[model samples]
Structures are given as C-alpha cells and as structure tokens.
Target: MTNRALVIQDNHHQTFDNDAFMQARNLKAEYCNSGTDALHAIKSHRYRCILVSMDMQKENPVEIIGALRHAENTSGLSPTPIIVAGKDFKLTQSDIGRLNISAQIRSHHLK
Candidate 1:
C-alpha cells in the first residue's frame, strides 16, 4: 500500500514546501490548490492524512470542514485526520461546536 497524503494550500510556495517535506518522509503527496479540488480529491481517494491551509481563499475553511464531514457521512469512509495550518487558525467556540475536533496544538510545540 502506498503511503499517500493530500495537501491543500492556496499559496503555491506553501504547497511546494509541504509536498517536499512529505516526499522526504517517503509519502506520496498530492497537492490541491483550491477547496473544490481538495474536495474532489477527498471523495476520490483514501489519503493517510490531509493537510489543509487555513488561509485558503477560494473557499472558507469552515465550509471545507463541513464538506469533509458530509463526505465522511455519505460515503461511509473513515474520517481522514485534517491538520489545519496557518497563524490565523484559531477556532472560536462556535466553530468548535460545529465540528468534532479533538485538540489544538500551538505551533511552537511542534519540533
């Protein structure tokens, strides 16, 4: 089985960096630059994990999260863990109430 990962980023540079990192770790990384394409990828393949840039401009992050949830529910696919990245990735109480997120880690905590 291939160790595959999907990365969604609005910025090309960020996407390139993420793809390089994943490749270095021996993962088959696929890149999607827009929410629509991300959603399409989610529906079409089983990714080990998904990396989503919170700063995606083509579609709101909340909307993408909702669509992911919907895809999980409708397709009977296991929930793919999503790593939301960006300095502005703060989730409000309302946002937390809307999605089933497990935890939030500060960027500084990452090695």
Candidate 2:
C-alpha cells in the first residue's frame, strides 16, 4: 500500500477523523470538508487512494469523483481509485455509473 491517502468527510459526524486511520495505517492523510476542498487537495498532491464520504455535500460525492477523473491538467489519474463512505445503505447502489468510483464503505462498519 502507498503511504498516502486523502479523506473527505462530512461535518455531521463530530468525531469523524482520519488522523487515527492515518496513524494506524502509517499514511500521510489529509482531510477536506467538501467536494470542492477535496478537489483542491487532489490538485496539490498525488495519492494512491482517496477515501470520500458518500453523503458529503448532499449525497453528491459523485461530482467530486467526476471532477478528479476528468481533471484537464491531471488527466492520468482517471484510474487512481476512490472509496466512498456513508452512513446510509442507499449509497451502495448509487447510480454512479458515470463516475469512476472504486468502492463504497458503509459507515456503521467503517474501518
């Protein structure tokens, strides 16, 4: 595994933090509040994997995924891979056929 991961999570979970995950996994992790913030982070650094909250910014993490996959200047990250996380089960089947999302993680059993 690479030593870096970027995490985008909603503000709803007051205690939701990627620090612990980063420390435990020995990764260089960065956190962002919204899809926009995440996009900025992506442009600044290259990550092996990106973990994003599913319902962030109104169940629209797909847009962020799209933006990354379609970045004009950074076109090769199209296959970088992303993991979507959320508290709801509905996101598992989210119609993200247009986005290049890699996986979905349910918050109840989030690792």
Candidate 3:
C-alpha cells in the first residue's frame, strides 16, 4: 500500500481538519480543492486511501465518489479505500454500499 492519501475538499465548506487526520495516520496527502483536480490526481496515482469532504458547496460528495469509482473501473485499477468526512451525512447504507465507501468519519470524531 502507498503512504499517500488523496484529500478532496472545498476549503470554504470544509467541516473537518483533514491535515490533522492525515498527520495522525502518518500519511502524506495530495489535496484537491475540486472534483476535477481530484479526478486527474486519481488517474495519475494510487493513494492508500481517499478522504472526501461531504460539505462542498460546489460539488456533491456522492457524485464525486461515483466518478472516482468509475475511473478506477475504466482504468482497471484496484478499489481504493474511501472515507467520507462530514457531519450528519444523509447517505443511506445502500448508498454507501453502492459507492463502496470504506468508512465514514463524523466531523466531531476527528481530532
């Protein structure tokens, strides 16, 4: 597994301190402020994990996850673990299963 992570967030709407999470995990992160940037990064590199902020005003986190999953399928890449980070996300268990999300980290749960 790689020691890097892909962190996608809209700085204006970020609900959690992603840097602290990454630091605590001892993993370096490549930050993407937009879904477009995130897609490009996923195409070029494999990350140990992906942490996507669910509070983005410009992009829907579910759609972003779908796109990322699609990219992985099309490129024949292995599924990367994806953790949704936010507070009170409305996703149902079915949605999470369909998206193959690895985990959910509530904003208040993170240091």
TM agreement with the true structure for every prediction = 0.75, 0.71, 0.94
For candidate 3, lDDT tens digit of each residue in 36-107?
Answer: 899999999989999999888788989999999999999999899999999778889998999999999999
Question: What lDDT tens digits, residue by residue, belong to model 1 across residues 37-91?
Answer: 8889988888877767676666787677778778887989877777666545688
Task: Evaluate all candidate structures by whole-model CA lDDT and list the values in order.
Answer: 0.69, 0.68, 0.90
- For model 1 the local lDDT of residue 106 reads 38
Residue-wise C-alpha lDDT for candidate 2, range 13-90, written one tens digit per residue: 633345555677677877777777777877777787888776675547666777777773365653666877666635
Top-TM-score structure, candidate number: 3
Task: Report the number of clashing residue pairs per model.
Answer: 0, 0, 0
Show model 3 residue runs off by greater than 4 Å: none
Clashing pairs in 2: none
Q: Which stretches of candidate 2 lie over 4 Å from their true place?
A: 12-24, 57-59, 72-74, 89-97
- Give, for candidate 3, the lowest lDDT window spanning 10 residues: 10-19
> Which ranking of candidates, highest lDDT first?
3, 1, 2
**Local distance difference test, candidate 2:** 0.68
